[model samples]
Target chain A: MILNGVEIRDSFAEAFPMVGTRLIITADTAKWAMIAAKTVTGFATSVIGCGCEGGVEREIPESETPDGRPGVSVLFFTMDLKGLQTVVPNRIGQCVLTSPTSACYAGMEGGAKVSIGKALRYFGDGWQIAKNVDGRRIWRVPVMEGEFVCDHDTGSVSGVGGGNILILGASRAETLAAAEVAVEAMQKVEGCILPFPGGIVRSGSKVGSRYKGMFASSNNAYCPTLRAQTETKLTPEVASVQEIVIDGVSFEAVSACTRAGIEALVALGRDKGVVAIDAGNYGGNLGPFHFKLREIMA
Target chain B: MSGFVLTPRRAFETRVDLAGVLPGVDLSGLTVGYGDRGVALAELFEIGGSVGDRLTLKSGSALLDRVGAGLSSGELVVEGDVGDHLGQSAAGGSITVSGSAGAYAAAELSGGRIEIAGDVGERLGAARDGSRRGMSGGVVVVGGSAGPRAAERLRGGVIVVKGDAAEGAATDLIAGTLAVGGALKGKAGRGMKRGTLLLRSADGLAPGFGDALEHDLVMLRVLARRSPDLAAFLGGAFKVRRFAGDLNAGGKGEALVVPAA
Candidate 1:
């Protein structure tokens, strides 16, 4: 299928099951809230080495936030519950707890609850006080800035990860620009995160590596430099390819991200050098959620 | 008047308890014991409404005590002034009184919401008789003034007094929130262990209380959203000057005074 004169591959984006939790971080101002949110989600681009994938889901207005302060909602995802439990508390305690004029609240409700404040309250060193308000337990930990109020626990739900879109462009700069637009659009999709660096991954991977110790390696088929040496997936006209990986709280969120990313690129038109939009999948062997690129872009 | 309307037929000198009668049932055969006399509800009250969970009492008698005592559920609306022990030991559902509620209103309330649109007598939302804790759960909102010792020994839940409160509010409060939208008389939060007393006006901090700096508390925003009546009183105040007091006690309790901005 073709959308806006750009080719839409029939392949689907394969996504694996993940565990995720959302956190609402509020501060006296939107800037500080974003600082805290960015800090909490920092270094969390991919699970390959970062242990988790996280990003700022959206900005929350003061009226909607628990503390009546400007806030940001962040989503953190890991491979398992154990990994999620370990990463969430550590990230929130170190990042949000340390931020100025910041408070943390659970963004999602009703799931497998993992303690955030219940565990971080010990940082107050016996001075932390637990307050039960409106049936929600909150911990007021005295910090140098004043007090950091954190909700007792945050819930983790089953999530979808590794939903991807492949952008094949004629030039490196054009492909990078198109990926930037795609990421910008995907960022607006709710309950999802583009977990690659700058939301663009240059070195897309296959299932296994040439070496024995590695589980994944570079996708040589999409490499322009090795197009002559191997049976390449790219055409002679395609010079650069980049992939945008997404992780979200649900399959709908992943699909939303994919659709938005493709639409944004399509809106840029063919003259922008984005020739084709495809998706990544391990031949239906990876996951149950299959987001078809043609259907999404169509 | 169209629903269940219970009007007093005679001046009941005896303390009448309307605890068991519920709406949506045939009340013609219903009877409640008043003092030492087993009074048939049909003789005392002109029951007129159809079957439902809502029971409205018109021309409420001040002599009617324990109007909804030990009420576990259902809605009981009183049109006129009611005597003491209204909604005592109330566990669930709601009770709205258009007129004044007497002493011990919603005392020992474990669950549910009680809204008194008019003044309430002494010890509103306070501990029940011979009990250590008051209002272990639930919410109480008084549109008018509240008597002295409001929320005394309150262990949990929230109590919002939209109007002025008499002296000794929040005295010995164990936990929970008590907010006074209007003037609070002297000695509020006296000997309190823990809890928050949000006041709109602060004549002066009662003795033994230390002045704390004006700080921004996000939890208040959460509270504001939860209780619209209390939010109306707050007028959207996210920052408040705190006065931690009852030093004679644990000094954990706080009186958050919102300065007019």
Candidate 2:
């Protein structure tokens, strides 16, 4: 589909099933809340190496939070519920609990739960107090800085990961600028997150590798440096490619984010050094969820 | 919430115990006590109204005790004053009193919610005579002052008194939170083992309680958010003076008294 002078490739982005959960990390101020959000979401770009993928979904107002403090809502995704149960408590204990004047709560109310405060309450060393608020149980651990209050557990939801769209252009700078704006637009969709740094990934990977130990390697077909030697998916005019990977609590959320990102990049058109839009897939064999670029934009 | 309506036929000649009479069940076949004799409920008041999820006492009386005792489900609404042991051992459902309630309002309460619009008599949410656990699960909100030994032997749950509390408030609190809005008189939290007492004014506390430094406890904010009934006591940032004790029992319990506005 060609519109606004940009080509929308017919290819689809493949996504795998995952277990996700949302958490509200609140602090004394908005800055600290954002800091806590950033800390827990760091080093979490892909589940391949980091064991999870996470990003800040949005900033929550004081009136909406459990403790009436400024908060940042974050979405974390792991390959399975067991992995999510293990990784969530560790991240919350090491990041949110250590932050100054910070408290954590469950952002979503549905589905099964994983222990957050229930896992870290022992840090109080017999000083911890548990209170049931409304219907959910919460723990108050007396810390040096007053106390660290957190929900007993957070709900775990079914999610989709590795939903991506690749933006190819003539130059690295324009492609990057387009990718940046696309990320900014896609993040506006709730229940989803762009797990990569700045919501943009330059090294999009394909399954399998030449090295026996490595599970994944770079997408050589989309690489400009190897275009002459490898079977290229790009034309001669295509120079740089940047990918936006989305992880969301559902298929509809990932599709909405994909549509939003493509619309932002398409708004710039080819005159803005944009060449085309494409996606990565493994012949529809690896993951169950599929988002066709043209069908989504259509 | 339209359910059975029970109105008094005449002034009670003697005290009446109307416990465990909830709207969720068949009231026509039920029997209750009048003075020293057992009588059918229909003889005391007209049992007229649809059987649903609400039980409304058209007018509560001072002689009517245990109005909603052991209510397991449904809503019980009282339009006037009630006698002692108001919601004893209520495991579920909600009881709302539009007028004052007598002593032992919520003794041995394990679950559910109780909201009183006026004053409550002594030993509110306290342990029963033979039991050590008081108000183990659930919430009791009193819009007016409480009598002596309020929240005594509280093991869990929450109790918020919006008005002044007489002597010995939270006297033997074991756990949970109790926020008293007005002045607290005499030996509060004296034998507390683990619990939080948010009081506005506290004087003549026992020597077992030691004054701890002031702190902006997160529990205050948590209670403020979860229980809106305590908004009058916590409308702004609540920087409180912490008194840790009763050391004779265990030093874990804390009484956070907010400096008077």
**Off by more than 4 A, model 2:** none
For each candidate in turn, the TM-score is 0.94, 0.95
- For B1-261, candidate 2 gives per-residue lDDT tens digits of 579999989888889889757877778978898888889988998888978899999879888999999998899999999999999999889999999999999998988999999999999999988888788888899999999999999988889998888888888889887988887888788888888787775564656787887888776777788777555567775788898888898688887878655
Q: How many backbone clashes does candidate 2 have?
A: 0
- The DockQ-based CAPRI class assigned to model 1 is medium
In the predicted model 2, the residue pairs found to clash are: none
lDDT of 2: 0.89
Candidate 1 structure quality by residue, lDDT tens digits, A230-250 = 899897779999999999999
List, residue by residue over B205-224, the lDDT tens digit for candidate 1. Answer: 46867888798777677778
